[model samples]
Target: MLLRSTKAVFTACTLVAATAFAFAPRTAEACGGCFAPPDPPTVVSGHRMVMSVSQTQTVLWDQIQYAGDPEEFAWVLPVKPGARIEAGTSAFFEVLEAQSAVRIAPAIVDCGGGSSSGCSASFAASDEFGDGSAAPGENGGDPVEVLHQGTVGPYETVTLSTEEPGALNDWLESHGYNVDDSSQPIIDQYVAEGFDFIALRLQPGQGVKQMTPVRVVMEGGSVTLPLRMVGIGTGAQTPIVLYVIGEGRYTTQNFPEALIAGNLLSWDFATSESNYVELRDQALTEDDGRSWITAYAAQNFFNTSVFDANFNSTTLIQFYLNQALANGELSSSCALGLGYFSGTVENPCPPGEPWDSPACGSVEPGALDSRQLGCVGAEDIAVALDGLNVENVWVTRLEANLPRAALSDDLTLEAAAEQVPVNNILTAQIAINPEEACGNGVIPRTIDVSNVPGNRVAALMTTALASIAAALLLRRARARLARR
Candidate 1:
């Protein structure tokens, strides 16, 4: 039940889509807290945030900027014990988004027996780090315990723990972080729950422009996200995209899941894309301003080639095992052996040796090496994890739009194993039209109408007939009276 959480920040809003698709499956839980008032505010417009959570790990990526001074850019994150921090490449996210992005294809509606008016169709398509060093700090007897201090990419990182909340704020302020009164309450909450803090700041002479994507790996039972901390800066609402890759789909444990009305899907005639903007917006709105929407879910088999150019059985086993370790599905010790067998083996890969090395190869003679037993040169790790069945591997994506009020709460994921099927891939994309228009070229026309002029003619004829009848009745009455 060890849970890990990752936080990422980026520079522009355009990267939201790409960052959203970069996720791994793991279990997650929620923690309560608020962020200190940033001097210039951390949250801003045109910023994108993405998070991924499974049973054992959680990953978060977001965009950040230095609003005040280059030296003022800093971030504080809450994490469980055994957290590992490192820089990540942007290519990983870009590739995932491209592979998993929702593809919008124009649909053709033929109005049979039509002259020129019938159908409409269209088509469409589409981090930071800092040096490796830590400032000298006092140790021992301090309310806060500094576990690790080092440079990751362009940011200086410090992992610390303390039972006293006030000491945490002081430690952060002493370490050159902008910790205001607002941060204390949040710090207290985490402290009460025995959570550790990871404080990050730009290295000397390093600006936010030099910031890169950072990954945080922690050990815990459930995924925990400190969204309230994200609200410390200025902003009306923040858009959050999360992808959960696991055995099955995941849903929100704390918030309601946004219900998507796929039935309302319509084609946008102007843009040649599905007019899903309304539907997406409506789903986000109906959730009462804060909710998680399961946008996409399915099992995906990734080709081992994606990880290694010279793919082989040894490489394939190593790749899947490494992913499993990163996601907390497999332990480091087990990963070294591809987590295939639990018993002792002779001539195992030496400590620090590559997993694909012959030393790590199976000792069974004439039998296909571990790589052969595990199919190599395949698109996915199915052969390596044949025991789990490749068909059952799946990834789920969730999305949310949060206002400042909603940021006070934490986000957690809950999923059941039975919800997923083996050997199936389910992918979904929200179809929002850049231009709102229903694509069908046909405009509705009124077929039945009664004109005012026609009504006037009928009224005149009825009046004339009534006048003639009245005159005849008067004549008949007068003639009868004379005869009498």
Candidate 2:
């Protein structure tokens, strides 16, 4: 599908040494439609980033969302020198979201007296996450040394380093960079702290305007995120979503960690909305709005069905064959045959290879080109899987709403004390009564409060709801028997 573009500024910050951050224009929606309550100066709503850390190596993928003149789009990230930038695909985020998004099962309903059997409904898992936009401001500098300059996908990239204060800005301006005036201090701070900067913009004449995601591979496994630079062009209550792939579940080290009280979660039958968001807000508010929630955590939990469908060895071979056909390198589709004493071995199967293997399958007039297998999106899948070390890796999803003032310090990440997994599918314990939903019954009832463990009121409410539901079911069963 084509991404709809608009006219607005993109702003954001990211780090290889310390995690990363991103910002969208005030008019644009923040990362994945996840945002904190609206407040003035909250120009940047939220952003999504993926970080994979194994041993001493780290790989980060940041999706650069931009809505404005393509020429005006620029992005800058801080790294610990020697970081390499590469192209990343949106499929990585899309697949991850589909697998770990918070899902709610429909409430079980019961009618006191009715011809219909008490309702028990279920729904397919679905979510409406959004994307955030961000681009860097420009300027120039004298002592700024351009370390490495090259192209990655459709972006023109340059890595710069400087010890002199304000020299980075001068060099950026001289090179036609459009960094914001307010960002000079942040840039200088990184320089003082010994961090190299990688800047990017659209390659002239690339034709594509919308910016895609980029990957940064660097040494060191520090999980600190540079939030100070995030405040440069963001508003209060900035939302941040991070997906961490590591050896174990990672949580906030310097900041407080918050988890949504599952027992407090309820479904509002009237509005068809869950109290998940409200509970999330309350949890953060209780922590003074400077905490990260371990939204979802698990190990060996990726759903590779999408990747498998589009990028297996069979699909790769088919894609290569299709490309060969289009190039007229192959006359027609080919198949491998094995029999006792074949008349002539004309482009026969490779010797000793299994007949079912792709290696043995050759196309008419020529062999399938191995280089063209990348056209099937196999490379992107490989990048995500390999970079993340998907085998036996622990994946953690973290979220937070940081007020502008709270962005004073960078966020540090560390493995959680307990290595337990947190499920994203939240089943509401409280159920809104249908009568109450229609203004007839009393307050909504808590059907199953077992999640709360020690509440007497919850136990009583659970017993009452259970009795009512049992009576309804008994009546329905009796009516069915009578009819029979």
Candidate 3:
């Protein structure tokens, strides 16, 4: 049993999170869970979540970030009844985030009359919460009902339900959870909406240093994130990064959708700043701080280089071998190519023996037994691939910085009207010439605002004026030559 009590308010830290999804149903297995927080009072440093959706079920993997005393940590989620809890690993998010993050291609610079290395440069950047369980109060007079209690991964988890206004908080307090009075209204709101609350705490002797991630599985339930709960104990601007995998591209239905206008951005050779942030902030600001940018959207979106490199046969076998060695089940003399899928192998076993043999080579890579790779939590990869049908499914990544005011309403998602895909690699359209880099860098030679919406007329007018100015300079030169 675990228990703690402190005055600190409960904070559910999710990056661009708190929503529900529906997708194909599958057995809950291990996956990437919450992120590891380095310090207490975990601030709004953005969040990441993955949702696989289908008609009948939705599996969401969220990272929980909490920096505080291990025993004092408490995470509460307003999930639909019957939702199942499961353990997740950090590698799942690590791989997906690396594969999907935005990358900026280096600027194509033409340094006439000289060669300078600083002209062209490329840029790229890769950039959750709770579970716990406790002994249920035995007093028959308690109003809160303990629906389910069990251990999932490193945390002990418990699901509770009650209709009374303050019964749930009272129960949480009795269990040694430091529930603050400010959260009562939101807790009441969720309770009034017929939502069940789940509280997770680290199991006995478990500490915050270990990043334990968890997921909530909902069946046949169409739900949106509870943004109200996410706003508690957060700063004014909370960045939410959401990834949705489904049959087709998805977009936020309630909040306005914005796209980073790549054409308007430029790479500054002098400063090495891509100016991408300026355009992104400008677009979001135009939407009153309640917009989500569709950073990447496409079908069959996995990066073969990143995914295959991590999930290939060689790495899986190595991981299995490491596990075997640590468990003292196999001798260090065992070679890499040979592995036993199940049953303990004796140290210095006879080679090529019928009863004691290495069988890893005979099994196909895709068909390799997942049980053998349990030490690395590779099952979460299979769960994602199978549940989302990765090869044929659409993956969408949305980003937003929601001011506290915008978090009042839950965000809803729907299939995008246009299924066109957006590329994550942004190539700079504007080029720079190092010879004149300090003074706008030959922008007139390449800058074309003609294709830009609502700017065609201005582009043409500017072109005409430049042509007229050139002709005037030519006439003056001719007059001076005649006088000489």
**Predicted structure with the largest TM-score when compared to the true one:** 3
By lDDT, the better pick of 1 and 2 is 2
lDDT on C-alpha atoms for all candidate structures: 0.43, 0.51, 0.51
Q: What is the lDDT of residue 347 in candidate 3?
A: 19
Write down the lDDT that model 2 would get: 0.51
Q: Rate residue 316 of model 2 by lDDT.
A: 22
lDDT of 3 by residue, 1-484 (tens): 0001122111122222122211111111111112112334332222356776654455677665433454445567666677767776554554444445555433444445442324334353311111133346753666687888888777777888888898887778777666655567877887787877777766778765434566666664242555776555555566666777766788887789887777766666555656676677677765778888887776664423111222332332343233333323233523333333322111121221222245423333344332333333334433443333334566787777677788777766777878877655555566544334424343323434435563443223322332332233334433544575
lDDT of 2 by residue, 1-484 (tens): 0011112111123721111233221112222111111221122222457876654446677764433233334567777777777766554554455445555543433433321111333322223234311122232333667777778767788887779998877767666665567778877887787778787766667544335667777654556666776665555566666787765788877789877787766665655556676677677765678877887787754322221222222222233233233323234643222111111112223432323457755434433222222232223333333323333566787877767677777777777888887766556666654443434453333345354444343223332332333233334433544575
TM-score of 3: 0.66
Model 1, range 1-484, lDDT digits (tens) per residue?
2122223211111111101111111111112222323444443223323444433334455443223344356666676666666554332333233233333333223333222111333323210010032334656567778888888667777888788858888877776665556657756776776667777767777654424555554432344455655454424555565544444456776788776564455444444545444555567765567876665555533332222222223232344343333323333323333434322112233432334666664544422233432221211222112222233444555656666678777666666434642211111122334222323443332111133433332233332332332233334433544575
Cα-based lDDT at residue 96, candidate 2? 53
Quote the lDDT for 441 in model 3: 46
- In model 3, where is the ten-residue run with the lowest total lDDT? 23-32
Q: Residue 91 in candidate 1 has what lDDT?
A: 24
Model 1 weakest 10-residue run by lDDT:
10-19
Candidate 1: where are CA atoms >4 Å away?
Answer: 1-69, 111-121, 125-137, 208-210, 271-274, 301-391, 416-484
Q: Which has the better TM-score: candidate 1, or candidate 2?
A: 2
- Using TM-score as the yardstick, the better of models 2 and 3 is 3
